[model samples]
Target: MEKEHLIDKYVQGTISEDERLVLEKLKLEDPDIQKEIDLLSDLKIVTELEDKTDLKNLLKETEAKLKQGETKVIPLFKKAKFWIAAASIVIVVAIGITSLLNPFSPSLDELYAENFEPYKNVVNPSVRSDEDIDAEKQAFITYENGNYSEALTQFKALYEGTSKSYFLLYQANCFMALSNTKQAIPLLEKHSTEDTPLAIRSKWYLSLAYLKEGNKEKARELLTEVISEGGFKTTAATRLLQKLD
Candidate 1:
């Protein structure tokens, strides 16, 4: 039999003595074999524990019966001690299942944390010297130094004074860095619609903003556009889309 078949049989607790000895020898030869066996064993436990719908339905029925004024003679299953034990088991099983599921299938917040990064200041590289430190230069400086709140103020002022659309992009980036997606999304949306070089880049940031806001549908939509546009963030967008799916 194949090595994989032997491992599967071992995990299912159905391996013959000879097959078990073979797997034990394989584990002695390779540490990764033992790790794989452990992972599959854990997954099997989680899969088996996932089927608690019957227990949950029974609890609900007991609750409904109690609510309907059945105070005469409760059955054994409806006893207070039995209800407490069953409810405790359900809670423990649910928590275990959630913990196991998270690694294989990350939550939206985890995915966003893994993927969302503030777009860098490629459009306006900050000058190293302080000789000609104008408002725009100072804004980029604050942004590059990770002072997002101050940078947000500076970028807003620059945008209002000069009516420059690129400043909007920087403002959105600052909001994103500050974990303020609600403020960032509209600015990114406006910049993304413009016919400018930075517009394509804005879509990528907008997708991340949607992700931070827990709007997966909108994030997926924007990421799809980023991929179809075939520019700066295409590869990253494709990977993020796969994770979302």
Candidate 2:
């Protein structure tokens, strides 16, 4: 493929399977192109939050600038040929192109610094027969191990019955771990009402699931429920609740 057509097709997303394979290979080989993809991927994650009106406005403003000819295209960070460098200065550019093709692919959120870290010294001490506690525990272990399907199977086993709210909550967590927020929402909604130990926790998870599903009002309602509960507040949950305001 010619250089000009390759770049044009890649941007247009009209690249065929073969061209996409070629594009991926070229992105991995090229440092500069990789950075733009990484930034787009990172931005994509933050876009999931539903109540992000300020962000929406900002993007609209950026687009408006483009309409007004105020937008500047800074390829290679400069129009000057002499300023070109051989290596990418951004660490994300070097390490991120591989993550962009299926940017929504699920993984444990280790990048967030607070996601999925233990809230407290969580010790599962359930003495119930109905709830398959081992299965739930192993599900998270499998989640941490990156086997989403196996973990989901283990979680579904825990999903039956309502004896253990912890199992119920973590079952919902497994859906989240797999990035199946659509499946997660109803499970979390079932636990979102008061009377169970996990009610507040359910609202927290439900808000995020709503956000992931692009339902801001529902997310806001759930977040409000969490704040109003005045219980089950963890640092990560609290941060999310704060953002709703």
* lDDT agreement with native, every candidate: 0.76, 0.56
Residue range 141-192, candidate 1, lDDT tens digits: 8898999999999989988999889998989988888888899999999999
True-vs-predicted CA distance for residue 75, candidate 2, Å: 44
Q: Over the stretch 1-245, how does candidate 2's per-residue lDDT look in tens digits?
A: 64334444554456688877876777788755554443333334333434445445545655576587643343543323212221222333333333333456443232222333322214343343645646555556666666767756765666564355555566677677667778877777776654766577777777777777767678677667776767665555666644444
| C-alpha positional error of residue 230 in candidate 1 after TM-score superposition, expressed in Å | 1.1
- Candidate 1 overall lDDT versus native: 0.76
Weakest ten-residue segment in model 2 by summed lDDT:
80-89
Model 1 lDDT at residue 12: 74
Q: Count the backbone clashes (under 3 Å) in each candidate.
A: 0, 0
The numbered model that scores best in TM-score is 1
The most accurate candidate by lDDT is 1
User: 229, model 2: CA deviation in Å?
Assistant: 1.5
RMSD of each: 13.9, 17.1
